[model samples]
Target chain A: MNYTLHEQEFTQQVADLIQQTACILPEDIERALVSARALEASDNVAYSVLDTILKNVDVARKQQQPLCQDTGLPVFYVHYPCGISTRIITRCIQDAVVQATADGFLRPNAVNPLTNKNSGNNLGIMIPCFHFMEWDKPEIQVACMLKGGGSENMSIQYSLPDAKLSAGRDLNGVAVCVIDAVIKAQGNGCAPGIIGVGIGGDRVTGMQSAKKQLFRLLEDENEYPELDKLEKSLLAQLNKLEIGPMGLGGKTTVLGVKIGMVHRIPASYFVSVAYMCWACRREVMSYKL
Target chain B: MNKKIEMKTKHIQLPMNKINTRKLKLGDKVLISGIIVTSRDMAHRWMMEEKSDIIRPYLKDGAIYHCGPIMVRDGEKWICRAAGPTTSIREERYQSNIIQEYGIRCVIGKGGMGKRTAQALRTFSAVYLSAVGGAAVIYANSVQSVKAVYQLDAFGVPEAMWVLQVKDFPAIVTMDANGNSLHEDIEKKSIQNANQNQ
Candidate 1:
């Protein structure tokens, strides 16, 4: 499969994608919020919280403004044809991020860890992180998620078979870890959040898998039966906590829970949880040339 | 725990007096009007160090917002594009001092602060309001104008201090001056629920 990748044209398209991604809350996420609101009593504070969140979504889309003050770090997952050069793709996405920031579609969120200096633009070392994979498809498929710092802070990882949690290297232990993380997070991650769990990989890979699971649609069913059961059970148990919206008491604590698994070595069993706030801004674009 | 209790709504004016702040209770809804000074991690640190006279007037009997708004310039004036509360817990260290020294009556942000800040709220007659997190455009719509800004050049836009005049900006009283915190209550309840589930 041979193709010509036009650099300038691609950059502008990616910029457009970033702008749309920043402003629009995806439908599935919006739907989940509406349903979550229905679960709460009309007089409950949680209902008011969800009502405000839904209204915010509408205003942001109409005004074409960034959904949150912290426009967050732009993360991309690109699937391209075998012949497409990933280097060109990376450069184009980087340029798109800079363009989007200038246009006020995104806030300049990239900061230097060592010196605590912001680049003033959304461009810095590994700022808009990218993951590229070559596939048999002819078109280039790019999906972007704007992950905010508030929820990012809530993301946690745990090594199993611990004495404290009494969580062994089993599914029961995995449930314990996930429950504990949500309890600790409370309303900080912007409750009625979406939970993405990664089990069995090394520490770093485990986190990566958990974040990637966020891309899965809230309504989508897991292919694996055991994992699906765990997802359903955890979702029920978490809502029972009644952390509600913004950690204020109500009914809905999590909108959905997604779990993904990978192969692991005999010695270590790691579980990583990535908590996404209700905003959950993600968009996908397929360019067929 | 009857969930049927009606939540009261109040319209609050900024540069609020201690009497007005003390009347607020947990779970009450608030619509704030008047001027609010925006400060984040950097601006809070700067307030501690400089205590600049320029900002002191705004803080006295006023509200301090934990926000990093996205602002755009149209001609000479600054337009607030998206302004939502950041997590308030980040400011737990500097918040108590800022409230006491500046005579701040209200603290607005999401994710309630720690025990120290709660104690200060009781001592100083201040309430902690939780604005909806990620509701940036809704917040931006309430801003009538940007009166002034500090450290725009040094701190950049998001981290800069924005003094904004607003009308009817909505929030909930998650932590009140009477030493009640919805955050702490919810956390304890959730822990009990977790135990029961296990």
Candidate 2:
């Protein structure tokens, strides 16, 4: 089988994606910000904080600077066609990250956990982490997520039966767990955030689901009506906590709530919540080359 | 009513008022019209290792900041290159000792330190202030002047001590010397509230 590699085309697409990630604040995130401001209490300190954050985003975008100082660790999820070579796809991503860092489009945030020595190129061990999902189609789809440490530190996984008994199971149970985590997180995770909930899977799978759901647009109406309703309910419940922006007393604690679920064993269901800060940076690119 | 207390370090004397940790909420920006210094892991370590008088001039009634900032030199003057706050958790090992040894009145950084530091805060009538994390540029604007850089040539930008003169720098009172800590209180209350509601 003869395989054609269009290096220029691939390079251009990845570069454009990186630029888009750097310059543009996703529409869903923008809407969430507006929603947070509107839902915030009038006398709340978070109101001003949220306003400052929104203003910062504007300044960063206008100035072509990073939305947040922590450009974050680049994580890539690739859906490759069965015929495509995994090695080639991985190499392409590595190349893209190198080019992006050199161009100053992305900051190099990868560092050794123990030694604290930075890779300086964002290409350290297990970095630009790739997770492959095989698809039957002929084209590859790459979703890139720049996961910041602030919110990423707040990710949690609960064993269903145990958490359910402790916190009470059901949608409200999930909401309470999430809100509790965020509040306990205080300003550490950076607030005016989004929460991604993954229900009904094993531990690791649930975590992955929650993380993957973060890539979805905040305004994306859920395909499953029940999940859609639950998302809205969770968002409302979380906002009512008055954790507000940046954990100061206010109304809008969470910008949006997204729930993704799958079938699980009859005995147990796992739940995971992943938080993403206002500086959510992600992009998706579909390429033929 | 705001209760006022005087914090003295070396030569610097700071008159600060006791504010409720709950009320001293995050993002409630305030003009911190008090004495604060820029100190972090390396500076703290140097202070301990040498027991040096290098910090004596600045330790007077001043607060120490835990930061490893990026700096650049222009001719004779040094400027902050990317002076962002490092995680405070890293300094849990040295903060308490440094605070008591130096008679430091306050510590500033993003995220709060551990229990020992909190205990030191209570024992010494000191406080820990949480500066807005990731707002390095915003914090930089508040810096009025750079007084001096200690151990400059040997240590890199992040590790050196660059003494600064700042005015009305914004900070949230996270831990107070009176055995009160906003971070601790919030975590306890939040967890309790969560358990009850559950």
Compared with the true structure, what per-residue lDDT tens digits does model 2 show for residues B1-198? 012111110122244423332233333345554445666666677788987787665765567877655444567986643344555766888888887787776678765777999888777667777665555445555576788888754444455687877766666566766666666655565556545554
Q: What is the interface RMSD of candidate 1, in Å?
A: 2.9
Winning model by TM-score = 1
Candidate 1 residue-wise lDDT, B1-198, digit = tens? 234433367899988999989999898988999999999999999999998889999989999999999888899999999999999999999999999989999999999999999999999999999999999999999999999999987788889999999999999999999999999999999999999877
Clashes of each: 1, 7
The worst-scoring run of ten residues by lDDT in candidate 2 chain A lies at A40-49
Tens digit per residue, CA lDDT, model 2, A2-111: 34667667766776787667646687787777777776554444555666566656655665545554556788888876667888878887888887776656666666
lDDT, candidate 1, A1-289, per-residue tens:
6799888998899999999998999999999899988988877789989989999999999989988878788899999988888988899999999899988899988878776677878888888889888888888999999978899999999998977999998999999999999998998898889999999899989998999999999988898999999999999999999899989888899989999998899998999999999889899998885
In candidate 2, which residue pairs get closer than 3 Å at backbone N, Cα or C atoms, i.e. clash? B9-B60, B9-B61, B10-B60, B11-B60, B12-B60, B12-B61, B37-B63
Off by over 4 Å in 2: A1-3, A12-16, A19-24, A38-44, A80-84, A102-107, A114-116, A134-140, A163-173, A266-268, B1-28, B31-94, B103-106, B111-119, B140-169, B174-198
Where does candidate 1 chain B have its weakest 10-residue lDDT segment?
Answer: B1-10
